[model samples]
Target: MACVVALLAAGCSAHATEAGPEITAGPDGVSISIPVQVTVGGMPAGDQVRVWARTYDRRGQLWESSGEFVTDGVGRVDVSTAPSTGGTYTGVDPHGLFWSMRLPENEQAPYPLMDADDVVVLLGVDRAGTTVARTTLRRVVREPAGQVLPIAEAGLVGDLYLPPGAGMWPGVLLLGGAEGGRPDPAYAALLASQGYVVFGLAYFGVPGLPTTLARIPLEYGLSAARWLAERPEVSGDRIGVVGTAKGAEYGLVLASTEPSRFAAVVAHVPSDLVWPGLGGPAGTQTSSWTRGGADVPFLRSLPARGASSAAPNQAIRSADAYERAVATASRWRLAVARIPVEQITAPVLFTSGDADGMWPSTAQAQRALETITEAGNPYGSALLDFPGAGHLVGGVPDLPTTRTAIPYGPVTIESGGDPATTAAAVRNTFSATVELLRKAMPRGRG
Candidate 1:
């Protein structure tokens, strides 16, 4: 056995020793979405050892996860397959440490509004409250060979990610949710590393865009699509759009209105009808979108029933409000507010969670699918409805899923779903989306 010396800062002697515990991490580095295999050895047989991880989030704040496990007969703990007895997460999970990370006690931090940069995680092995071994792991968002270019021309705001060694890659217009800012590029960077030209667009809440979600012009989305298609690095004919929540709603509307533009569509926690905008003035009712200088018809959110006793920071589920509005909407209003998904010419993939606390995404996705089917649309469409999962249904796989409710502007929004199930749904949905994109929009080498 090779002698391994613990860091002097960890209160260990400088001299190398073979008797102490040792941690080994494989692949040294990987994309943020990939999992790393971790094993701790050289410990007392059947003894309890704690494996802890520490990393800084995009905001440079500390985030961490730890698990206590009993070593095997041979004094080995394989984190990749071991069932965590207690700590930040429970059950057997390969990416538990990554997805179960949380802020330190009583530390209040805002939810990250931007994509995380490369993450460096420090892993330590604690035996009887003493650090015995440590190692480092690198998680990257973009490949070294890739390039990111900011787009602010033609009334579009976004970041275009070019794949490494690409000829002309399939283009993807990535959109964010009701948060209304530049779409986080973490997912786009990962997709770019996998050979897609992803444009992380900011439709509103920027210097050049609208200050809020109210009455935004739909033509902005179409203009962004047209600009992306014109890019030399993008295969104009093979373009797709991927959006989450309000962004999903926007993407569907765009595809429906301009059926020939998008070759593929992926909507996460999608809506079946056009709904009112957010972040507007108090007691104001306005459509979320507009086209050709006219306000698009939309369903207004019903008034909150009564004052709630929930704390300010507590997560509040808004799904009930949406359900009530839909149930009470008049036939004329429903006809006008419903998204004409049947007009979409491209293949569509809808992902939703039954437990979506933000909205009834599962029901809405089902309605959209039914609309297309009844219209006899030639293009195929499918829905991935995950039971028990919440509104946070899709994204880069293997990040922290422990927090279902997070601070959004002033109030905390409860996205629903527990950590483990939501983690699984994220992984599965991401894989399915990639598979669909590869098939529907193939990349071409330059």
Candidate 2:
């Protein structure tokens, strides 16, 4: 370690100032462990690291528990990202491990790895990674309290999060943002922190899964809610879904359609109308794709106009393809899910980003959300937009690795803040949302 390396501040932002770290993948057959040596210039920081790593199969079904582990000295740790099965092993280590699920390979959804993935390490905050408070996660990731009873339907492959202790805890199904692809522990950590048993499961991953909007279904989400309620530790009847981005539409689907499953929801950066998908640019100004940042330019690498052009292709259908696919399930686009805002039966807290540039339904989502409140539906609806947030929970500025903005937003950011901070805020918001539900539907609780 160099005695003198530059650092930004004791605190960190998404933008990092390091030359990026090295993530080396292990051997072939077995799921490889990628060693991550985390540092902040001159500072040593492995003692304060927490790791959460998960990889999904080809059908978008999440394969395993994202390991939430601690690091050794030298501020380094290994996250096991590859599934036990065969495939290319591409693992990732999150900042807090609370939210470090980046889409790997040519994968928009996560998958098991057999070969090694081309690794790129992006630096954010410039400060050393924080060691998780030993008891911090134990407070949430423990066994359910009381006895976990069976709900109406606790079927196979359901994604669920259970909070510390149990019995009638506020519960929610966490939708992992748009595309339902990224690893979003933020929502789970947040809601669970606030005594909400939250299951933030992956819906899209693997190779054969139907990732398109038209083919996506809410049956999985519905069942998860019902199953959570049945848990002896859970007040399943009080279940809610916290949907973000495209997941917001799913949240609406649960609350409006399966009104019984979800008691209420706090949708962050939600889409009023579901389309193919929408997301913020992978602003990597400070990092380099050529070096070790995000490898795929994807849409994020395109100019704002080019990136924004996808809006017209909402259903992921071109003029001709739309006409062709319209006859089949692929084009009917369940993505354009109808919430019937006029008759919305569940309580909802709708949040959007003021600075998000990704939206095929930017105008439409705002209007559709507004229409619900205007209708005076029995449901409770409130909209909150971050001061300058893009699509993420942290209110960090929109910048790539090399061109990150010096943030001016409050430390308690509304948009994309750091992962732990984002989790904390979400937890607080979930607590408030639970209170609102308790008021609206007394029986909704245990």
Give the clashing pairs for model 1.
167-446
Using all chains and alpha carbons, the TM-scores for the candidates as numbered come to 0.93, 0.47
Q: Kindly list the per-residue Cα lDDT of model 2 for residues 58-83, writing each as its tens digit.
A: 34433222232234454444443311
Over 1-446, each residue of candidate 1 has an lDDT whose tens digit, in order, gives 13233455444565444566899876766787666898999998999999999887667778889998999999999998889999898778888888888886566544442264676789999999999999998888888889999888888888899988848888899999987777867778888888898999998898988999988898999988888888888875647999999999999999999988899999999999999988888789899999987889999897433316557777788888899999998999899899999999889999999998889999999999999999996777899999999888788787777667766666777888877788889998998899888888876621
Among the numbered candidates, top lDDT falls to: 1
Give the clash count for each candidate.
Answer: 1, 49
Q: In the order shown, what is each candidate's alpha-carbon RMSD?
A: 3.9, 17.2
* Residue 236 alpha-carbon offset, candidate 1, angstroms: 3.2
- Candidate 1 residues lying further than 4 Å off, grouped into runs, are 1-19, 113-116, 304-310
Give the Cα error of residue 446 in candidate 1, in Å.
14
* Prediction 2 global C-alpha lDDT: 0.41
- Per TM-score, the best of the predicted structures is 1
